[model samples]
Target: MLDQISRGAVGVLVVEDDAVTRKTLCLAIESAPELKLLTAFDSVKPALAWLETTRPDVLLTDLGLPDGSGIEIIHACTHRYPQTDIMVVTMSSDEANVLACIEAGASGYVLKDAGKMDIARAVLDLRAGGAPMSPTIARMVLAKVRDGKKPQAATFPTAGDTTSLTKREAAILDLIAQGDSYGEVAKLLSVSVGTVQTHIKNIYGKLAVHSRGEAVFEAHRRGLLKLGHPRSE
Candidate 1:
């Protein structure tokens, strides 16, 4: 069965082993007007079973599950429902696990200690083509790239040697890399938020990255962008 999701709400399927944590996640999704809880499961078995027929817009899953790893779910959803965005909400801070999840098609990773609002916001951000990662997770990802521990292929495209981005798109990328919100970037460029989002979408297409984090990471890796300093307008 499916949820009674609202018209414009993002349908979320939650998979957390801990009963309390699962409840908390469901509550968080329910609290957000833009989010709808499609279903909550505590194990890989039933979650995978449900996934066979239902595709959620977002999958917020714990890495460790009773029946299997959440990576399995990520792969399944990625292959079966390519449109679905996956996020890992777990206690694991291990380097291997972090990289594994990203490789397996998870777009966002947050520690379980993150608050309800942050989790909900991360879901929205993920849906909006932004990769919402915990600060520690973000650091680990960049560190992996900096250390030359690059995987043969990323879930999203990495920057090519001759990646081409228009000046405005590059400027928007730089601003976003500097932690500017969409509205902030819009104001800085004297454009509407929709325009900023359009430029960002084009940036994603050129960079072949799905989320903001991946875009910034790939750009920095290829020296296409300077993270903290936006180019002078």
Candidate 2:
């Protein structure tokens, strides 16, 4: 399967323990001509082994494997191949595991019940630098940020310290924390998508965060966002 991957295609690696689910994921990946099924593994061991030598453009992994948690695979890929976009395709949606996966460097999260087309679209979205999360997962993530326990003294900036975000940047962060996609944020802000992306890049730099979940968490931690309330233009 590795050798069969077409040149210049988006290589995809899937890790799922269930035979039926794994096959379904493979079929979904194969259905996209722009995507290539580099390989699929049923456990973390082979997936990690393959990852040591080869890095796929996208990784779609389930949280629970027969041998261990898939978060290990996510960590490994994120640490070793920062270019690879890691995604969680699992039935588990509990806050703990979901937060762990996001912290471990998963840019996308999708439930197993999502249709094949949704899954395919997620892959394409990730390749396009979007953080794609299922609607339920997105709400869970937002709730977690809103209700997060107060940070330790040293873990966050001091209360008197400013976040150094411009009004536009702060507004953008507010919309993002509200679970608005890039396109939606752009439309809401009356800006081009590329302009929204540039603002997000600046936001990440200022907050020292790399992913949407982290940015939201950091923004909430810094008290820069008023949860459940829309920002004025």
Candidate 3:
């Protein structure tokens, strides 16, 4: 495991076209000794290209960019470095963009109108493994949750309704549902190949299934995976 930096020295890539906002964001990040402002850009293209090289551990970006939507940045960064967390620091309160950013794998979302302290707090939260959203933004997320519009609730079965899966077997089922290879699952579950094979065999017996494809399909039917998640991507 990566040692948790008590006061993590952050390498941040800021993406914003507005000069004032961009500078203000950079200054806020620079004010913290633990936070190092690696770079800032006015567009998505150059920022993303730099990310391929520098690979900043944290990214703060505005949704409205001259080159492309911030969602593109989220996709590019997370694809290249899954450990690097992403946050949206934008003026747009449009629910569409917010939801899109989340779908693209943004870990935190905050508004640009936040005060300097608020902005710094957000960066601290990102470095500390917390998602800090503006009050309005937080409310919006909660509203979405209460409305039951998010995929999380409907995507998986509740514990009370889960079928007879041993804890280890259930863990394997989760990996399979995530489209992981059996070998990857074995390594992740930290068991030998034969042990993994036996777990899968037990899973089949309990579920009355045979074949990998059949097992995955049944897992989907039971709502253990999202409806449209690629079963074998």
Go through the candidates in order and give each one's C-alpha lDDT: 0.79, 0.82, 0.69
Of 2 and 3, the candidate ahead on lDDT is 2
Candidate 3: clashing pairs of residues? none
lDDT of prediction 2: 0.82
Cα lDDT of candidate 1 equals: 0.79
Best by TM-score: 2
Please, what are the lDDT tens digits per residue for candidate 1 over residues 69-173? 998988788778866889999999888898778766687889877544467888988786566788888887866655542442343344554677777888888
Name the regions of candidate 2 deviating beyond 4 angstroms: 1-9, 113-117, 129-131, 149-155, 159-163, 228-233
Q: What is the lDDT of residue 218 in candidate 1?
A: 64
10 residues in a row with least lDDT, candidate 2? 146-155
User: Which regions of candidate 3 fall more than 4 Å away from where they truly are?
Assistant: 1-8, 115-117, 149-233
Candidate scoring better on lDDT of 1 and 3: 1
- TM-score, each model? 0.73, 0.78, 0.62
Encode model 3's per-residue lDDT on 26-89: one tens digit a residue: 9887777667788899998998889788778788999888878888888888778765768888
Candidate 1: the clashing residue pairs are: none
